[model samples]
Target: MLTSKQKKYLKSEAHSLKPIFQIGKDGVSHKQAMTILDALEKKELIKVKLLDTCPLTVQQAALEISMQTKAEVVHIIGHTIILYKESEKEIYKLP
Candidate 1:
């Protein structure tokens, strides 16, 4: 679990990042979740965008992806979600 402070820091860090992945009409899938896991390992923090065509709500998609990837949902705003997982590289020093 991320403290509010850590989440705040991550949100700021992710502010300028483009979404690394998008969840569309098909919704979250196993393959996509696995790919996101790989990405989180590499980047520590990432943004995922939900398209208008997506059926799942932002909260639902965030939960599914978080469960599948074992990454924390740092923040959700509009249709974008920020996720964070500590990596071996220790990419972002969290507060």
Candidate 2:
């Protein structure tokens, strides 16, 4: 779990980032989860977009992806969600 300050810091850090992946009409699939997990491992922090064509709610998609990838949900604004997971490479230090 992340502290409020930590989440706030992450949200600010994520503000300039573009969504690296999108959940479309197909919703979150295993392959999508794998890709997200890989990205999380490499980048530690990432942004994902829920397309207008997606069937799931933003909360649902964020929860599902966070659970599947074992990442933290740092923020959700509009259709974008910010996720983070600590990686062996140590790219970021949580606030």
Tell me the whole-model lDDT of each prediction, alpha carbons only.
Answer: 0.96, 0.94
lDDT of 1 at 61: 100
Q: Give every collision pair in model 1.
A: none
lDDT tens digits by residue: candidate 2, 1-95? 89999898888888888999999999999899999999999999999999999999999999999989999999999999999999999888886
Winning candidate number (TM-score): 1
What TM-scores do the predictions have? 0.98, 0.97
Whole-model alpha-carbon lDDT for candidate 2: 0.94
lDDT of 1 by residue, 1-95 (tens): 99999988999999899998999999999999999999999999999999999999999999999999999999999999999999999999988
Instruction: Itemize residue pairs with steric clashes in candidate 2.
Output: none
